[model samples]
Target chain A: TPFRIQNYRTLAYVLTTLVYLVIGAAIFDRLESTQESISYANLQTRIDVFRQQHNMSKSEFENLTRTVESRLNYRKKQWKFIGSFYYATVVLALVGYGHAIPYTKAGRAVTIAYALIGIPMWLIMIQSVGERLNSLITFVLKRIKRHFKRKREPQITAMELLTCEALLTVLTLATGSYVFHRYENWRYFDAFYYCLLTLTTIGFGDLVPMQKDDYGSIGWLYILFCIMFILTGLTIVASSGNLLILRFVETNTKRSRNERYEM
Target chain B: TPFRIQNYRTLAYVLTTLVYLVIGAAIFDRLESTQESISYANLQTRIDVFRQQHNMSKSEFENLTRTVESRLNYRKKQWKFIGSFYYATVVLALVGYGHAIPYTKAGRAVTIAYALIGIPMWLIMIQSVGERLNSLITFVLKRIKRHFKRKREPQITAMELLTCEALLTVLTLATGSYVFHRYENWRYFDAFYYCLLTLTTIGFGDLVPMQKDDYGSIGWLYILFCIMFILTGLTIVASSGNLLILRFVETNTKRSRNERYEM
Candidate 1:
């Protein structure tokens, strides 16, 4: 019953975060839309001034303006509903791809306030999921250990644990690379590099998948799964690293104690 | 003696990380420079082709090329030594400002490899520093408690700790805002927002400071100091949050235990 209550609490927290994101998206859209329009107007004025200075014909001026407008339009497209949602996700996760940034002062303020609350909420959500994943990992490891015991093998050592962690990390990297190579049309090495960068949360934005037009509907699903996978992978890797450090410290302390006793 | 050993060990780790960063920067610079030259040549050829096709005069072509070259140079500046160092710091911190991304495939791969080793090293450095800072904070708190005791006041409670954390956060935000507003020539609110965004490690990259002129030699030092301040601030806030969460969980568990006994 308590476990159920905890699950419910996590669900509530998640739902609250989703609601906040939706509201944030709407606010960002409104704030940024006004700024975008003002900038567009300013661009038009600049184009007009340039056209007059050059004494360009209407058709030539139209061509020049069209080129500039299209460039601006491409940028503006990133602030739409779905794009804003993606931006909010990045901000909450602290990945901050920096593809779409707030232009208005109000937008910046709201963004700061939103992140102040949103990041912790996001962390809580990730922590809950990570805890569950950790439990599952432990269960699997225990089952493997039991199997080894039944086979009359030696007990699992710290070295074995370290090896297992290293193997998992390599496997995760390989699998991620394979998937991204196919989806993003990248080279195998680039895909692996992207996976490393993303899972580490370095997200340099040089190679973001799902932004290209080719993937379409599947892109969204792939991105969702990839994010979850990355988060889970990071949690596992961090825990393993922590365990390794703990073991090393424990051994050092024990050795030092023995030396003190001998003295 | 162990504490002294720890201090030495931490120093060694710091030096090792610095050495690693230096090597990484050199590698990145060589890799990126080669790629940049190739790209620049390609751009020059394309510009030449366009100019010839358009039958432009030498002066007109020069003007066009100059504009394009200036834009390229602006981007190229970010790959310079100081900028690369900043980029490295952001990547290792998992902040990923998404400015100055690696262009070459080899560069990307090297970045991934570098991060795999670098991030954990960076974390260890931050952790060691954070522990020292935490001890310092505790010592200061104890002194304040002793002062209160001398005044015959009530003992400090968890509530006071929470209040102190809140006050420190506010003070940090205000001080950062004041400093950055003066440095960046930004409005007070924008500076405050920038501080929040950066310290939280969201780093949207829309508003970067110290990249401008006028600050000169001090800008580098200021950036270095700001980064240290942000890292220290993050550690303190995280620890305070953890403490708060632990207290809440303990209270809930105790309440539940009492209820179970009653039942």
Candidate 2:
């Protein structure tokens, strides 16, 4: 009966996830498709006008644009020492912004090998850091509780720890978002979006910080700050994820262990 | 002493990771920077020639190129029904190829909300599936062992499980790479890179499958296959990661428990 119940629960989860995905897809399509088509048409009109004005054929204009776009891209100095460090951070974080990916086969091969080793090491490091973070939080919480309620023994519940972690996650996001908003000159909401994306390791690279102009003027301090933000932010988020997922994993492990014992 | 040793180990891990990142950065810079500068200069020359031939000013050419580039980007129809599903899958997986992100404010807002719930749910789903996969493998392995050795109890070791998981991972990558290479018309190495990037959830978007032309001809089956590939590949990889990390986590947890008992 327990096995059957587990099966049903997993099935329900699968179906719910399927439905959830479809709903998300439909909402995105509805919200974005019209705007996408309208913008496409507007851009197409602009392209036609530019071509006519320049008296250039489609292929000629395409060639010219490709060269110009690539030229603009290369102006960024993305393979420099600092930029390469940024690349390594993203790769280790599994963010993979693809803003300035390897152009050569060797670079690609190296990236694959680097990631193969780096990602797991990064994961373990974060999880270890996260565990220490949890212990620290527990200690601090107990201390606070003892100070407040001296009449009773200091006690902390799982619920209390979860609440603390949840608040920390939100606080980290808020502060990080504000910092990025100020630094990147992006709108507050967009900065928040960027922070969340980066923290989650989605890293769309739609808006990355420390561009060519920033590197030229902002100095290494800003670059160091950004990398630290990514690393620290992920550690905090992973701590939260670890707490939530560990309970589920433990339950699954226990159920399997019970089944094994029964057998 | 154990605590101190554990601390030292973590410190060593941290230092090693830092050194690894630095080495990777140096390599990337060395391999890619010179090529980058040369290509940049080449593109600059092409841009200059085109500007002189077209009799356009720098700003005028920049504007033309901007509009043309945006137009080219929108021709892909990335917000359609199927593409939207792909987006949802990427967001859930945290792959985030980002070839086409939501352009609207509403879309970004919804995305954040969606991911807040969806990512954890997806994580649980994959992890549960991975556990089941491990059980299935164990059962199959036992059966095979029994068939080969009738007198034996067919006990499987942790090492055996690990080896099987690793072999399964390799097999999955090989077969998946071959399939994508055939379907997407990419070089075998590129296809393998795409598969690795995807399974690791890096998703650089340097090379994504299923373009507009593919959509026109490939139908829904290919879409389904790609989605399934991502989900299955991630589950397998996560299982391997789970085995490796669980051992480390258990050691850490046991050490902490012993410390608490001593206290």
DockQ of each: 0.11, 0.59
**In candidate 2 chain A, what residue range of length 10 has the lowest lDDT sum?**
A254-263
Question: Could you report the Cα RMSD, in angstroms, for every candidate shown?
Answer: 17.8, 2.4
Give per-candidate clash totals. 0, 0
lDDT string for model 2 (A1-263, tens) is 65555656666777777888999889999999999999988887888888898898989977876776676566588998988998999999999888887888999999999999998888888877776677778878877777888745676787898898889889888987887787778899999999999999999988888874754455677778889988888988888777778767777777776442112
- Tell me the lDDT of model 2 at A1: 62
Model 1 chain A poorest 10 in a row by lDDT: A254-263
Candidate 2 backbone collisions, by pair: none
Per-residue C-alpha lDDT of model 2 across residues B129-176, encoded as one tens digit per residue? 676667767778888888988847778787998899999899889988
Candidate 1 per-residue lDDT, tens place, B1-263, comes to 43334334334543443343334334333333344345446555655664465566668644433333323323323544445556666776777767555655545655666677666655544433333333345446667767766653434455665666677778788888898888878889888887787778777766676567557667767876665555556665654654554344344334333221111
Measured by TM-score, the strongest candidate is 2
Global fold similarity of model 2 (TM-score): 0.94
**At residue A196, what lDDT does model 1 achieve?**
79
Give interface RMSD for all predictions.
Answer: 18.8, 2.6
